[model samples]
Target: MKFRSLLIVAVALVAWTNVPAKSASGVPTYIASAVTDSARPPDDKAQDAKRKPDEVLAFAGIKPGDKVVDLMPGSGYYSRIFGKIVGTTGTVYALQPTEMDKAAPKGLQSLKTFAGTPAYPNVTVLVQSAAAIAIPEQVDMVWTSQNYHDLHDPFMGSPDMARFNRSIFDALKPGGIFLVLDHAAAEGSGLSRTDDLHRIDPAAVKAEITAAGFEFVGESKVLRNAEDKHSLSIYDPSIKGKTDKFIYKFRKPLS
Candidate 1:
C-alpha cells in the first residue's frame, strides 16, 4: 500500500509540472470592473482593444487606497480608469509636463476639464516642468504610457534623464512599482528613433531604470506585435494603433 501511494504522488507532481502557464488574457475581477466602469468616455472604451487596459492594470497591481501618478497623462485615458480602480480612498495624480502644454495647449484641455468634474474627484492634475518632476507625496506606483520617449525629445525640454529617473526612484515608497509602456524601436537603435519614430529600444529603458536603483521585476508581452518591422514612425497610418510596444515593470528596493 505504501509503495502504491508513493507512485501516485510522483505521478501527480509530474502532471502538475506539465500544466501550461496561465494565458495573458486573464483579467482580475477588480481590474475588469474598472475597465468597464460606466463613467469612462465612449471614445476611451473604443480604444480598449488596442490599449489592453485590463491586462496592463492587472500587471501594475494597483489596488484601493494606493496613491498613483499618471506621469505625462496626455488625455487622462488611463487616468480615468485608474481613478475608478483606486476608489475614493486612493488618489491618482495626472502629472503633465508644462512644456507639452506650451507646445500644444488644446491637446490637454479635455483632461484638464475632467480633473475638475465630480466624476473623478480623486483625480488631480499637476502641471510642472519636465526637468523637475514634483510628485507631491511618495506614491505606491508611478506610471507613464507611450510618453517616456517624449522625455528624450526637445518638446519636453530634454530633461536630464539620469536625474529624472532618480527623482522617480525617490518619489516611490520602498518596494513601490514603476511601470513604463512605450513604442519599441529596433534592438540596437538606442535613442536614435525617439525623435522621428517615437519609439525606443527596450534595452535602453531597462538600463536606465536599473541604474536608478530599481529592480527589473518582469514584463508583459500583451502589447508586443511580432509583425512590427521596428522601422516606421509610430504615427504612420499603417502602424498607428498596431505598432510594436513594450511594457516594463520595475520595483524600488525595500531597504
Candidate 2:
C-alpha cells in the first residue's frame, strides 16, 4: 500500500514539474543564442514574443556555416539574428530590392549599418533588382518573411513572378531551401489581397512556387491563428501581430 501511494505521489510530481521555456525546450543552442543575443536591439527583442524567432529559426534549420539570403530584409531583424547564428564561417546577404529603394530610400540603411558593424562581419547588404536578383554565389537558403506579398503590390511594379521565382531558384545551390513566411489571406482570394490586405492565399503561393520548379516540402503551423478571418489588412490593429501566418518550405531540385 505504501509503494502504491509513493508511486501516485511520484507521478503527480512529474506532472506538476514546470515545463521548459521554448528556448530550452528542444530548440537548438545556436538558435536560442541568436534570439537571445545581447547585441539585438531592444525593439527586436520586444517583438520576439509575437515573432517566435526560436521556432522560425528552428524551422529554417539554420546551421553555423549556412549561406543565407534574407530577401527584402527590412530593419535587419532576422538578418541580425542570422549573422550571429551563422557564426564566422557563414555568410548572410541582406538583399534589398532596387524597387524598394525607390519607394523607401532609407529603408535598408539600418541593415547596411548593421552589416558594416564589426559585430556582424559575416553579413553583407546587397541592392539588386527583384526582377533579376543577383547574388555573388549560390546560397544554401533564401528566407523571406512578411514581404512576399509586396512583390505583387503596385509599388513593386509586379514584375514577371515566374521569372522572379526562377531567379530565386537559380540563386540557390542544388537541394537548397526556400523558406517563405507570409500573412495568410482567404482560402481562394489568390493575389487580390496582396496590395491592400498585405496577405496572400497559401494555395496561390504554393502553386506559384511549385510552378517555378520547387518541390513543396511541408509547412509549419507555428504562427497560425484561427481567429484571423482574412478580411482585414495585416496592419490592422485587431490582427496585426496576431494574424494567421504560414511558413512554407520549398526545396530546389537536386537534379
Candidate 3:
C-alpha cells in the first residue's frame, strides 16, 4: 500500500513539473533585450504587444553572434530586431522580394534606409526574387515571419516550392534553424486559405519543410488563440492584432 502511494506521488510530481520558465515562459531574455534596446525604432516598438517579438524570437532559438537572413523583411521589423540581437560580431541580411519596390515602394525604401543607417552597421539590404531566394552564403538561421503563406500565392508567380525549400535547406549551416511563424488557418484548410485569408495550415508547412530534409524540432503556442475561428483575412479589423498564429522551428540535419 505504501509503495502504491509512493508510485502515484512520483507520477504526479513528474506531471506537475513545468518546463523551465525561460524555455516556455512569459518572455525570453534575448527577446527582452532586443525589444528594450534603444536602437529599435519607436514605431517597431509600438507593435510589440501584437507581434510578441520576444517570445517568437526566443522560441526560434536565435542567439548572439548568429548570422541571420530575415526573409521578406517587409518594413524590416524582425530585421531590425535581429540586427540588435546578433550584435557587432553577427550579420543580418534584411531581405525583401525585388517586387516589393514595384508594389510597395515605401516599404522597400524603408528597408534600404534602415539597413544603411549607422545604428545597425551589421545589417545589409538584400533584394531578391522570392521564387528563387539567393542568400549569398550559408547562415546560422533564416527567419520568415508572416510571409510564408504569400509564397504560395500566384501573384508571387507560382513559386517553385521545391526549389525554394531546397534553397533554404542549402543556405543554413548543418543543424542551423529555419524559423517560420505565420497566421494560422483552420485545421485541414491546406493551402486554400493562404491567398484568401492570408493564413496557412501548420501541418502543410511541417510536411513541406520536413520533405526538404529539415527536422521538425518543435512549435510554440504562445501566439495561439482558443477563440480564433481561423476564418477571415488576417487583416480583418476584428482579428488583426489578435489573430491565431503558429511558430515552427526546423533544423538542418548535421551530416
For each candidate in the order shown, give its overall lDDT on alpha carbons.
Answer: 0.90, 0.91, 0.86
**Per-prediction TM-score, please?**
0.89, 0.90, 0.87
Compared with the true structure, what per-residue lDDT tens digits does model 3 show for residues 47-135?
99888888778778787789999988888888888988888889999888876556667777888776857888889988888777888
Worst 10 residues of 1 by lDDT: 19-28
Which of the two candidates, 1 or 2, achieves a greater TM-score against the reference? Answer: 2
Pitting candidate 1 against candidate 3, the one with the higher lDDT is 1
Each model's Cα RMSD? 5.7, 7.5, 6.8
Q: Which regions in candidate 3 have their CA more than 4 angstroms from the true location? A: 1-30
* Deviation (Å) of 74 in candidate 1: 0.7
Q: Give the number of colliding residue pairs in candidate 1.
A: 0
Ranking by TM-score: 2, 1, 3
- Kindly give the number of clashing pairs for every candidate: 0, 0, 0
Worst 10 residues of 2 by lDDT: 16-25
The better-scoring model by lDDT among 1 and 2 is 2
Candidate 1 per-residue C-alpha lDDT over 10-33 given as tens digits, one digit per residue, 9 for 90 to 100: 999999986534434566566788
Top candidate by lDDT: 2
